[model samples]
Target: MSVDAERPAPLMHAWRHPAPKGAAGRCIGARTDLPVDRRKAKRLAHRIRAIARREGLPRAVATSPLARCRDVGRWLRRFGFRHVVDAQLAELDFGRWDGRCWEAIDAAEIAAWSADLVGHAPGGGESVRVLLSRVRAVHARAPAALLVTHGGWLSAAVWLALGEAHAPTAATWPKAPGYGRRVILWRLQAPALHRPSDR
Candidate 1:
């Protein structure tokens, strides 16, 4: 599919939330609600402003309900953009292992997660398929919007958008978009309709 320049572009910019204050090397998933690092939040706010200037303001600023994203949403709200919290944008629930350190988790369970990336739920949390469903739903509802969400959520969305043929192995499928990074994914617009005389 090719994009028609004549039509307004439908763009979705997914910005991974910056690392929350002191949330280093921990299993911080949907259940974890860490606050944004104060210094990092300042930097992120500036970048968001730059993005707004370049993109000419998003249709809406959407974020995961988690504090990491919600804090960023708060910053955006203060900046004058309409912010909305969508649970669909929340990170994958890590269940029992939500806030546990990676080293503290069972090695065998981590291996299980790797063996069946899509189906295995780390600490009995949401599966990859479930996360993808929610992410896709959000995209379908708001094709053109700015989203602040988790790395896991963003990775799943990218993998799904790439389609099954380009699907990667369990070891390589979902990849975290580095904190504070901005990724813009676009869908090509359908061809314009032409009148009989024009054709």
Candidate 2:
């Protein structure tokens, strides 16, 4: 069957940038524009495109509000997914912590909030719940999707999928969005089911 843009299959995929050596963050002074090793971009892109093609995610488009993400989208455009959207997938606007590194951010407040990460941000950023809500909104829009979002976004998605908890860490959030672990395994269902232990 031929893949058509208007009626592509539904799927959610998470892809990470190669690494944060010399990309978006601009922390690295001067290096190749590619977030990942340029020598390997072709190979990586080729591999990703193959998977997308194989999975029938021909419309395997991406959504993100970050320029870096868009830049990555542009790179992957040729893989039959020229459609990349900017959907506020960036880390919750730290509001105050946008540019400051972790060390530069207020430590005492950071420490206070770190104790309970789900509900607070160190420098008045978004809480995990809020972030999950926003990302879930995006998730709700499509039956299948491929988000070029940060690690935090992935973590929340994982939580929503499994209804379980995992350790959150500084490295949890991506400096630049990359391929997320492809594990949106369960089919979407409503909250109407009565659990066996619902007492």
Candidate 3:
């Protein structure tokens, strides 16, 4: 039952389900503002739940408490996830821009934010480094848990796990970095890809 005690510890699979990306300006809105992508949400939930079942997991955990994420976690719970931890999985908060559209962000603001996503919250959000440190601290102590945070957080996590000095605004490792794609899962082995359990 414990990661340390399993015949072969469960492997880490950082799946990326592109979360309704067309809402380019829509992705960072509040819970109530969540898009009505009922069809796509359900479809994504089904796919993720299927993976859990195949991987012999009853439920996958999460990294945030957003309504959209809670909805997905709830969906998985109904499908059969033993639990979905929501406290440690929130996406980086974009403070003042929390509920605005991408089109609304000032070009200079976006530029500044993009240029240095580590030191300041240009968009009034958590920096990549902040996300990385927080996520790493928590995930390091977790088992083979599932994380349903934002694309930024996921990409940063992958970057840190891969031993890169910094995470780029984009993930070049060809991974599932969004809301509807099947990103490759990777274990946090020394090399970041430990062998999966035989069972």
Write model 3 residue lDDT over 105-131, tens digit each, in one string. Answer: 788887887566576674665666676
**Candidate numbers, best lDDT first, in rank order:** 1, 3, 2
Q: Which candidate gets the maximum TM-score versus the true structure?
A: 1
Candidate 2, lDDT over the whole model? 0.50
Screening candidate 1 with a backbone cut-off below 3 angstroms (N, C-alpha, C), the clashing residue pairs are none
Per-prediction tally of clashes: 0, 12, 19
- Candidate achieving the largest lDDT: 1
Q: Give one digit per residue, the lDDT tens place, for model 1 in 1-199.
A: 3445874565577788887875787898888788877767667766877767875866358888988888887887888878899999998898898999999999999898888887778799998878878877887788778888888887776776555553345777756778888766554212222111100
- What is the per-residue lDDT of model 2 for residues 91-140, given as tens digits with 9 covering 90 to 100? 45565665545566567776766677777754565677677687677767
Worst ten in a row by lDDT for model 1:
190-199
TM-score for each prediction?
0.84, 0.66, 0.72
lDDT scores of the candidates, listed in order: 0.74, 0.50, 0.56
Evaluate model 3: give its TM-score.
Answer: 0.72
Candidate 3 residue spans exceeding 4 A from truth: 1-11, 26-33, 166-176, 184-199
Q: Considering lDDT, which of the candidate structures 1 and 3 is the better prediction for this target?
A: 1
